[model samples]
Target: MQRLTQLITCLLGTLLFGAAAAADAILPKPFTATYEVTYRGMRAGQITFKLTRDDATGRYTYETTADPSFLARIVISNAAVERSVMEIGPNGVRPLEWSLDDGKPGTARDGQLQFDWNKKLVTGVIEGEKIELPLEPGLQDRLSIQIDVVTSLLRGEEPGLIPLIDDNRVKRYSYVKKETTSIDTKLGKLDAIVYESTRQGSSRQSRFWLVPDREYLAARAEQIRKGKVETVMVLQSVQ
Candidate 1:
């Protein structure tokens, strides 16, 4: 009778755990977060980023505005990359091709994504590259980069990064876990799952935070590579 009871209890516990996981699978995520980025310089960049769910197509759009002239608006879907480039010194902005691949020239439109063993959807190609954020000494310039990606998995969303490798570029992302993190914004804190990427041999961390209740990354933070906290590279706006 004792052994039978123990087995029954274990089975019940397993069932409960499965139920909880399923419930977490369908939670809505963040739609958008307008933030600012700053580095060593006091320069500022205005950013409006969003993660919108097509609902009909089940695809998500990860988009942001960092450069005002060159790379103004970038929209990335599961396998599509769309960029709007501004023609300088003249008329207006024109659309350009955007690629999010690692080895290939990437596409002018869309990036490739895949699912891990945890069933969380994430970026598939691992491109060894890094894009440096403009900074100044003694002062952190505020800048923001919008992120838009699709899928039921929103794990690569957070601020700060732990780069794994870097020959040309450092690589870093989030570890799948059950911790509750809040996406820090100038407005307030919103709960999210943050991922990060970094170039090798650097002491900085930029993170992507996905608010499960929403559909996209609500915020991101880049810390300079200083002592203890290291020097941080988090600008609220992109100039």
Candidate 2:
């Protein structure tokens, strides 16, 4: 009977460890990253993105702000802010709410989104119209997609087809893994896995280089629109 008791205890221990490990896979390591944004090889602005998590409650908030630089700052009013608050769980990251401000006055482009998990629905205001749509399981928003991608890469898993809710439309995005490479940044040389995604029905493409050592944070990103580089951001610092 003692031997049987010992065997049961061992099995329980193993099961508990497995559960904890799985949960850790999705729990984000809180960090803030600032990237230098450039447009068509000319300095346009800077983007600062931050992530924070509460381990006890499994809640997280991700926010990003874009600020113009130099001449662009004087000529353009293109500042913007985006944020998402969600819950991280064993199943995946569930977006509780999201908001966007385009910095345009007297325009209806600013809106908010709310996710109803129990009803499997999303309600948001878009262009001054309130709409409701069915939400899919494992659905992610534009801001949350970054977290989803990083988490999947950290776990050595494919991001698959991510369903994104943005601009009053539900669009599906596909991520293709390219080759692993190293990126030279202000911080230093770092190894990363590259991923590319093309905009559906457009010539725009975006590439992300995520460094594994830094918890799969994107070290650099490039956005090309219509055969011209629209923006490029290299990791400037992290905290």
Candidate 3:
């Protein structure tokens, strides 16, 4: 009788776990956060990130705009807009579309990727070049990946290997938790968890600090390439 009781208990536990996972897959509340961008420790630009959800369709849209500061504009002279549309299911994020607009002051280069989950195909173009790749589960775009990382962390799950779509290519990146410490931001000093990105065979490295109380939002990010700091983004405001 004891063995039978143990078996029933295990089955109940599994069912409950599955239910909880499905409920939390909807994602956090809608929010907007602005970050001050810096390059080599100087003011450069600003990036505003926004996330919205559709209750009826259970879809999400994530958008970010990076604009160079007036002074910095003279040096860089370009801005970027990135966006991603996806849905979070019982498994993870299922990206539907990803796009970016990057170019000079007036002329812009447009790149977009469309995911057809039903057909299991990914089609897109990057810099006017045709692209086609296999569609895989758990795939995320550059922008959506950041959201998934924070969501997984808040759920007490390890942010392990992540499949991300970038430049019309699919790449799996591994993230390592560095440490949990306090960092000063425009808002104030706050405790944060830091994570470092490992991109195989790439010289560029990136890091992010996530604030727990704020739904595990990314408070700051730094990108370095070839031992030189390329850009930095720090939390400015949240709404």
The best candidate in terms of TM-score:
2
Model 3 steric clash pairs: none
Winner by TM-score between candidate 3 and candidate 2: 2
lDDT of 2 at 10: 15
Report the Cα RMSD per candidate. 18.7, 13.5, 12.8
Compared with the true structure, all predictions reach lDDT values of 0.29, 0.66, 0.66
lDDT of 3 by residue, 16-67 (tens): 0111244664366677777777666777776667778899998988876656
lDDT at residue 59 of model 3 (Cα atoms): 94
Clashes of each: 76, 0, 0
Q: Could you tell me the lDDT of residue 136 within candidate 2? A: 93
RMSD of 2: 13.5
lDDT, residue 56, model 2: 80
Worst 10 residues of 3 by lDDT: 10-19
The full ranking of all candidates by lDDT, starting with the best, is 2, 3, 1
Model 1, poorest ten-residue lDDT window?
10-19
* Regions of model 2 farther than 4 Å from truth: 1-23, 74-79, 104-107
List the candidates ranked by TM-score, beginning with the highest: 2, 3, 1
